[model samples]
Structure formats: C-alpha cells, structure tokens
Target: MKSHWREYIHCDPKILIGKPVVKGTRLSVEFLLGLFAEGWTEDQVLENYPTLTLEGLRAVFAFASECISQEVWYAASMVNQTQ
Candidate 1:
C-alpha cells in the first residue's frame, strides 16, 4: 500500500519517557505487540481499544516488521557460525 508506517510509530523524549508509541495515541507499539503475542486477534484488540483502527494495527505491524527485519543479519551470522 506504499504506507508510511513510521508515521504511526515514534518516540518523544517528553512522552512516555521516549517509548515508541502510536503517534496520536498514548498506546505503545510494544503494548500492541504484547497483545498479539498473547494470542489476541486483531478484532479482539480493536474491540478492547475502541480508539484503534485496522490501519493503525497494520501500521504497527509494519513498523515492527521493519525493526525485526533489521535484526535478521545478526541471526544470519549466528546461523552461519552454527553451520
């Protein structure tokens, strides 16, 4: 969708002690990641957080995916060492 997920995830020194949170909401991307990891569905998350939208959820996932992807090189190195 050519989306700018960065718009949805950011940290501000003045807010939440600089945790990466949703841009317009106080909810942190880490919180959402935890919910998803705990087996919470997108529908369930939205139901619990009426302020959140599908787009927001998608953005968080995209942002997290990008961050995790950057960590892949380290994992690759570990895998190479084990070979």
Candidate 2:
C-alpha cells in the first residue's frame, strides 16, 4: 500500500505555533511548498535537503492538494496583503 501524506503531515500547536510539520520531525509542509514556489525541482530540493526522500517530496504535493481541495479559505486581509 502507498503511504498517505496526511500520515506524515500534522500540526503541533506548540511547535512552529501550530504549523503543519512532517511526522517525527520539525520539518514544515510549508517549507517544502515554499521550495516549489521558489522553482526548486524535486531533484534540487532533495539535493539541498538530504534528509527528505522522494516520497516525502511527493507527500508535500499530496498534502497541499488535499488542503486546497478541502475547503481552503483565504482571509480577505491576507489576500489583500498579498496584493
């Protein structure tokens, strides 16, 4: 069976002020997502972050996809701030 990304990504409320992190580590999903937003290829990301495996990288994509699919909301203030 394939590993579910959700199994690896979760929030700690105490750590990172509640950001979603990889299971058993302090790595945040947003950190991985930021790499993609910055144009880092999977190979590049893996090369730079030797701790992350291809599966973990794929998990980032899966996790983000699920979040957006599950009624993600963009606060008006935050949206405006981005503009």
- Measured by TM-score, the strongest candidate is 1
After superposition of all CA atoms, the RMSD between model 1 and the true structure is: 3.3
RMSD to the hidden true structure, all candidates: 3.3, 4.4
lDDT of 2 by residue, 1-83 (tens): 02498766778898798998876666789888887899988899889877777777777788888778788699999999999
Which parts of model 1 are misplaced by more than 4 Å?
1-3, 72-83
lDDT of 1: 0.83
Cα error, residue 6 of model 1, in Å, equals 1.7
lDDT, candidate 1, 21-55, per-residue tens:
87878788899999999999999999999888788
Candidate 2 wrongly placed segments (more than 4 Å)? 1-3, 72-83
TM-score on alpha carbons, each prediction: 0.77, 0.71
